[model samples]
Target chain A: MAQPDMTRIEAAGGRPEAIRLETLRFAWPGRTSFRLEVPEFRVGRGEKVFLLGESGTGKSTLLSLICGINAPDRGSVMVDGTALADLSAPARDRFRAERIGVIFQMFNLLPYASPLENILLPLSFAPDRRRRVTDPRAEALRLTGALGLQDDLVTGARAAELSIGQQQRVAAARALIGAPALIVADEPTSALDTARQGAFLDLLMTQAEAQGATLLMVSHDARLSGRFDRVLDLSEIAMTTRGAG
Target chain B: MLLPALAWQSLLSRRITVGLTIFAISLSVALFLGVEKVRTGAKASFADTISDTDLIVGARSGGVQLLLYSVFRVGNATNNLTWESYQDIAARPEVEWIVPISLGDSHRGFRVMGTSAEFFDRYKYRGGRGLEMAEGARFDDLFDAVVGADVAAELGYRTDQQIVVAHGLASFTEHDDKPFRVSGVLARTGTPVDRTVFVSLEAIEAIHVDWKNGARIPGQQVGADAVRQMELTPGAVTAAMIGTTSRLQIFGLQRWINDYPEEPLLAILPGVTLQELWDLIGVAETALVGVSAMVVATALLGMAAMIFSGLAERRREMAILRAVGARPWTILALLSLEALLMAALGVLLGMALLYGGLFAFRGWIDDSFGIYLRITAPSLRELWVMGLVLVAALVVSLAPAWRAYRMSLSDGMTVRV
Candidate 1:
C-alpha cells in the first residue's frame, strides 16, 4: 500500500505544529499537591526546542504526558493532528508506538537484547512502524553507523556489554530508526560526559533534522541550551510545574 | 509471538534459577504420576489374579478372608473342607472342571500349594492364560515340585534342586527329612501364582502323614521310600476353584455351594470379591494420592516464590517494554507464557521419569513384591491429573503476572529502579 508522495506532503501540510498543548493540567492520581499546568505550548514542525528543567521539575512527567504515557487530569495533548486524550488506552499506546520516538536516560536499553534488537523493539510492538521501513535491520544499522556506534559493536554486543556513551547512541539510533513525527529526549545525555554529550547531541539533532521530525530535548543544563532554536524554563510555566525542580 | 520469544530470552538469561524451578516441578510431577500408575496397576493385577474361575469355594468365612487365603495366599484359612466335599463338588453335573487347591505349607516364605494335574490342565489366570513351563517338565513323580518363576529367581532354584517344605508358615519349622525335587520352573505370569510352589496332593499327604495336631510324633519318621508303601490320599483341602459347564449355570452353582449342608461353605464370584478387596484398601490409596498432590503444590509454590522474588528486578524491564509501546496486558501475557513453558517442560520430564522408572524396576518389583507395574502410556485419568497440575501451576504463576501488570501501569515508562 504505497501512498503517493503528493498525499504524504499534503498530510504533512497540517497547521505546522508537531506538538500543541492548551490549558494542560496534570496531577498524579494519588498525590493532589503536585501538578503540572501549562497554559500554552507549541513545537513547530522540524524545530528543535530545549526544555530546561532540573530533576523532579516535572520534566520526565511532562514528556510522559506529551507521549500519552500518563494522561492529564483535564487537558488536550494534540500530537500531529490527533488528540491523545480522546483515544482509548490501547489506541493511545498504538499512537505513541507509531508517532513518537522516546529516548530515555542512560541504562534504558533492554538488558537482554542486542543493540540491533533494541533498535528494532518499537517495530515489534507496532506493525505500522515496521511497515514504514523497507528493511528494519538495515535501517537500524544505518542509524547506528550515522550515530558513530561502530558497525561491529552494534551488531555483536548486548546492551550490558556496551559502554554508557555507546548505549546512549544505541538508544538514539533506536528512537530514530522508524522516523516518527516527534522525537522526545528525556535527559538522555545526563550520563555522558560533557565532551561526549555535545557530540551525541549533534548526531541526534542531525538525524532528527534529516528525518524532518521535531525534537524536544529536556535537561537542566543551561549550557547546552544555546544550540537549540528556543528554550522554555519549567519554573516560569505556572505554579502547576512545582516541587519537582 | 515476539513477546513470547522475548519472554523466552529473559528466562534463558536467568537459566540457572529457572532450570532449578523446572527440576522441582518435574520431580513432583513424576512422584504424582508414579503413585497413580502403581495404584491402577495394582488394581489391574489384583483383578486379573483368577479371571476364568467362576466361583471360589472355601470353608465358611468372610468373603475377603476366603479370597486372601485361597487366591492371594495371604492369611490362614479358618477351616478346611473335607476331601469328600471337594469330590462331590468336582463330580457335579453342572461343573466343567475343578482345581482343588491345598495351601498350608511354605518353602522359604513361598506358599506351597498341593494341587493335582488338573491344575495344569484347567486353572487359568490373567484372562484365561494357562501355566507354561519355562525350564523343565511338569511334576509327574510322587514328590516332584513345580516352583514358580519368582521362587526360582529369588531362591536361585533350578530343576532337580531339592527344596524342603516347611511344616508351618514360618521358615524355622522346616520339614527337613522329607524334601521334594523341583521338576519344573513356571514362566512368569506377573500374578500371585508366580510366588507359589506346586506339588501333587499326594505329596502333601505323604509329607505330613506322621504329623498330628500340627506337631510331629517323636518316634514316627517315615523314609522317602517307605512313603510309597503307605496310601497317599489328602484328607482335606484349603479351597476349590470351579468353572461351570455353562456360563449361565455359575450363579446356580454358587448358590448351591453357599447352602451346602455337609460343612459350612462360602462361595464368591472372583471379580466381585476382588472389587470388594480393592474398596477395603482404597482408603490408603487415596491418602497416597493426597500426599503426592501436596508435593506437587509445594513444587508450584517454589516456582511462585522464584518468580515473585525476581519481580523487583524486572520492574525496569517492564518499564522499558512499556516505553517501547508494549501494553500492560502484553507484559502480563509474557509472564504467563513463561509459566506455561515451564509447566509443559515439567510434564514432559515427569512422563519420562514415570516410564523410565517403570521400565527399570519392573523385574525387581515383580520379584520382591508381586505387584507388576507396566510401562504403558498414561491413562486418561492420569492425563487429566496432569492437566489439572498444569492449570494449578498456571494459576499460581498469575500472581506475578498481575503484579507485573500493575507495575507497568504505575511505572509508566519511568522505572524507579
Candidate 2:
C-alpha cells in the first residue's frame, strides 16, 4: 500500500468543514468477512451530531476511522477538509492530538493523574494545541469550573479517587480542553443516572459550542437526541460491520 | 520529558513491585561488583606480598611451592640449605645483601622466624617498603625477640614482656626455660609478615641446643647464660632473600645457585612466580564472575516478568494514554524507560553497598585474613559490566514494551475493560 504524504496535506490557520467522508470502506484484518462502507458522509463545522448505535453497530469503529486511529481500507476520511488518508501514521497521530479530543464511556481520565493533569494531557502531546493556549493550567481550571467540578477536586485528587459522576465531568473537561476542532464521545454518559446524564450532556454541549468544536456523540439512548443539532443512527452509516472483523 | 513524568507516576501507582524489582537487581549488582573487587584485591595483595628480592633461594621444588613458603609463610620447605652455602653466596661481589630466614618454631599459632639483623635493614615487602617498628627497637640481645603486628596484637604482648618459643611448628610444646623478652613490634603490613614472631638466629640455636631430631635429650640441660656464650650460629637456613648489586646479574646468580653441587636448590623470581600462581587461581575468579552474571540476569528477568504481568491490568491504562494522544511508540518508550530507571538505580545502590561494606569491614578483613582491600573507584571493566547490566535490563523489557505497543494499537481508545 502507498503511504500517505503528510507534508502535502498540511492545513493553515483558518477553520474548514469539520468532517467529510468519501466512499469510506474499512474492516479489521485476519477476519475479512465483516466490512463497513460509508458512501458519503459530512458533518459541518461546529455541528452537534448524535450518532445513535446499539452495542454491535460499529460506532466505535466509525469513530476510530474519523480520528485516523484506523485507516480506511479503500476510502478517505477528511477532517477540517484535510484528507486523513493523505497523512502518514505519525502525522495522523499529531493531527488527532491537535484537532480531535475523545471521551470514552468510563475511566476516561488516567487513573494515576490528577483531574487537571488528565485534562492537560493533550497539550503535552500537541505543541500546536499548547501554542494556542496562553496558559494551559488556567484553561484546564476554566474548563473544570465550567464542567461544575470544584477547584479542590481537580487539584490534588487523582482520577481514580473521583466518583462516577465526577469522573464523567472530568472526562468532559479533558475532551473540551485546548478547544480542539472536534470532540468524539463514545457512550460517555452511560454510567450516569438519567438526571446526571442530562446535566452532563448539557455541560458538554455548552462547552463544545463555546469552543466552536464539532461534537459527534454516539449513544444508544434516544431521549437525548432532542438537544443535538443533528442525529443519525449508526445502523444507517455502518453496513455489515461485525465484531472487530 | 512528559513521557518520563507519566512513566514515573505510573510506576509510583505500583511502587511495591517496582521496589522489589529494584532491590533484587541491586543485590545481584553488589555481588557482581563485589566479586570483581575481591579478585583484583587478591591479585594485588598477592603481588605485594614480596618485592625487591632478586631471588628466593630454597630447596628444589615447584616455583609456586617455593613462593608459598618463602613469601606467604604457608607450608614447609622440602629441605634446608647448609650455612656454608648461604655464606658462600653472601660473599659474592654481586650480592649486595641477604636475609636468611629459618622457620619451624611457633608462639601461640603465630609462626616464629629466626633471622639476622640484616633482615631489619635490607628485607622488603610491597615494593621496597622496609619494616618499621610500632613499639621498641630491633632485637639486640641473644634472648630478645621482635613480634609482627598481628602477633603482638593477637598475643597481647608489648615490649619488655617475656614469651616462650615453642619447640616445634605447633604452639603446644614450649621451651619454658628459654623465654625471651619482646624488644620490638613491627607495624602492620597486611601480609604474612604481620603473623610472624622474629628473633635472632642465635636465639633459635640456643633454644634448641638440648634437642635433637624433634625431641629433648634427657640429660643435656644447658643454662641460658652458658648456652648464650656458646657457639649459637644456626647450621642451616630455610630460605634466603638475595638482593644483587645489578639487576642484570639476577638470572646469572639464580642459575649459579640452582646448580650448586653441595645441595639441590631452586631460585625463583618473585614476580614471575606470583604471576603463575595468580593465573592458577584466575579460573576460580572467572567462575565467580560468571555465576554473578547469571544472578544479575535472573534479577533482570524478574523485572521483565513484573512488567509483563502488569500489562493485563494496564490494558485500560494503555487505552487511556492513547485517548490522551500518546503514540504507540510512546507507550513502548515509557515501559522501557521504567526498566532503565530501575537498572540504573540498582547499579547505584549496588555500588553504595559495596563501598559501604568495604569501609565497614576494612579492619576486620585485614586483621583476620591479611587481605588489605581499599575502597577504590570502579575500574573500566567494572563500569562496562554495569553498563552491560543496564543494556540487559532494557533488552529484557523489550518484550513487554512491544506487547504494550501492540495492545495500544489493537485496543485503541476502547479497551474492553
Candidate 3:
C-alpha cells in the first residue's frame, strides 16, 4: 500500500498534497438511499480552500471521512502522504492527531478547562504534536496571544466563561497548535456576527499562513469565499445525489 | 494521568450531585463498618466475661442457660444447686478453688449476686485480670455490699451508701428491713461484671430470714443488725465456678461434677458454653451484617445511576474529547476513574466517621451495652470489606463506562445531544 502512495507522493514534488481524495465512494450503513461519491478532490500543501456546502449535504460526513473517523467504501483518502485506508483504526486516530487539527462550529472547548488548557489538549493525546513544541505551556500562551485572547482570560478563565467570539478564537488557537499540516474548520464562524466573522477569518488565515498549513474550511456562506485561495462547491465535487441509486 | 485529571475536573464540575453521591456512599460504608465493629466487640466482651474458670456448676439445664444466668447475670436459673452439692464439688482433690453464687435478687435494675469474698480473689475476667476496687474494699460483713462500676455510677451509690435489696426483679419485693451498706465499687470491666451488685452469700441468707413464700412474715421482720448476728449459712446456691488444680484435671472434674450421684447438676466449661451461646445467636449477627451489606450496595447503585444519567448530558463533552484525539477507551477509562475516585473518597470519609463515632461514644457504649469499642486501626476483616466495596464500585462503574465508549465511537467528532 505504501509503495504506490510513496511513488505518487514523490511524483507530486516530493511533498504530498495536504489532502487527496480519488474515486471516493461512501454511504452510511443501513441507509442505502443516501450515498456520497467524489471522483477527484485535492488540496495542495499550504493552500487555503473554502468548501461551500449547506446543512444535510454530506459536509460533516466528508470531514469524518477525511479525518479517518469513517472508512471509504471505495478508493483512498491520503492525508500528508499516508493512505488512511492502509492504517489500523488506532493508527489512523494517531495520524489524525499528529497531522490534522479540527475545529467545530460550536462548543469547541471543554467547558471545565481553561482556554490555555484547552489549547494544549491535542498535545496531551499526540506525543508527536507535543514533541514539536519546546515548551507546551509557553507555546499555548503564544498561540492564544496570536489569536487575540488576553493573557488573563487564557490563563484564568474557564472556556465556558469566555464570550462566543473569544471562545471561537480560543478554538482557532487550539486547532493551529503544534503546526499540524492541515486545519479543518466546520462552519467555525457561523456562531459569530458578520463583523466578528470576517475579523476571525482574517486572524485564522494569518495564523494558518504563518504556520504554512493548508486550511479546508466548510461553510454555506458565500461572502467569505473571496478570502480563500480557492473555493469548491460540495454539490459539484460530490457526484452522487441523495436517493439517486 | 491526564484522564484522571479530566475525570476529577468533570466530577468537580458537578460537585453538588457528586458530593451528595459520595455522602450517600459514605453513610452506607459507615453503617456497614459500624455493624461489623459492634458485632466483633460484643463477641469479644462476651468471651472475655469469664476466664481461667474450669467449670460452671449449676442445676441441670441447658448449657447456654447456665452460662447466661451464672456468668452474664441474664435470665433466672431453673433451679438452685444445694449447698451440700457445692461443698462436695469444692472438696474434690482436683479442684483448686471454688466460688459459690446465689442469685434471685436485684438492686434497682442491676442484678444482685451473692458470692463469697473469694469470688473477688478467685474469679477472673478479660484474660486473668483480677477485679480491682475503685473506691473501697470488698464486702466483708454480712450486710456489706460491693457494686460494679456501672451500678455505682447509675444509682449514685458510693462506699457507705445504703441500698435495700429487692427479693427478685420486681421493684416492690424489696428487703427494706435489712438495708445493706455499699462497701466497695469495682472498676469498669467492660463485661457483664460491670453491671452487677455483689454481696456476701451470708448477706443473701440474712435478707431473706423473715421472708417466706416470696413475702415477709407478719411481725417476724428481722432488723439489719440482728440479721447480721444470726447464723447465715446458705442452704442453696444458684451456681458455682470452679478452677482445677491443673489444666489436665479440668475435664475429669467437669465430668465428676456433671455426674454427681446425689443431685441433678450441670457442669460446663465457660469457654465452650460461651461459644455455644454465640452459635445460637450467630443468625442475628449474620442478618445484621447482611442488611448492612445491602445498604452499601444500594448506595453504590445510586452512585452508578447518577453517573449513567449524567452520561446523556455529556455527549458534547465526549465529542470534544474525541475531536481532541482521545480514543474511545480513554473515554471509558475516564468514567471508570471517576467512579473509583468517588468510591475511594467514600471509603476514606466512612473511616473518619467510624473513628469519630467511636471516639465520641466509646464510654457511653461501654457503660450502656457493656461492650468496649477500642479506638484502634481497622482490622483485616474491615479492610477486606472496604476493599470489596471499591471492587463493587468499579464493577458497577463498567456499565456506564461501556455505554460512554460506544457513544463516543458512534458519535465521533459530532454529538447531536
Q: Per-residue CA lDDT of candidate 3, range B1-417, in tens?
A: 788788888888889999999999999999999998899988887888899998999999999999999998989999999999998998999988999999999989999999999999887887888999999999877789999998988888899998998988876878887888999999988877788999999989988888887888999968877876788898999999998899999888888887899999999999998998998889999999999999999999999999999998899898888877788888899999999999999999999999999999989998778787767799999999999999999999999999999888877775668
Give the per-prediction TM-score of chain B: 0.92, 0.92, 0.92
Better of 2 and 3 by TM-score: 3
Calculate model 3's interface RMSD in Å: 1.0
The segments of candidate 1 whose C-alpha lies over 4 angstroms from its true place after superposition are A1-16, A31-33, A238-245, B121-123, B128-136, B149-159, B170-177, B187-189, B216-223
Q: Is candidate 1 or candidate 3 better by DockQ?
A: 3
User: 1 or 3: which has the higher TM-score?
Assistant: 3
- Across the candidates, what are chain A's individual TM-scores? 0.91, 0.91, 0.94
Tell me the tens digit of each residue's lDDT in model 2 across A161-200. Answer: 9999999898888888888889999999999999899999
Q: Quote the lDDT for A231 in model 2.
A: 93
Q: Evaluate all candidate structures by whole-model CA lDDT and list the values in order.
A: 0.86, 0.86, 0.89
Q: What does DockQ give for each predicted structure? A: 0.63, 0.57, 0.66
RMSD of each: 3.7, 3.7, 2.8
List runs of model 2 lying over 4 Å from the truth. Answer: A1-17, A22-25, A30-40, A240-245, B107-109, B121-123, B126-137, B149-177, B181-187, B216-221, B245-252, B259-263
Better of 1 and 2 by DockQ: 1
lDDT of 2 by residue, B280-399 (tens): 988998999899999999999999999999999899888877766778998899999999998998899998988998899878887677677868788899999999999999999999
Recovered native contacts, candidate 2 = 0.45
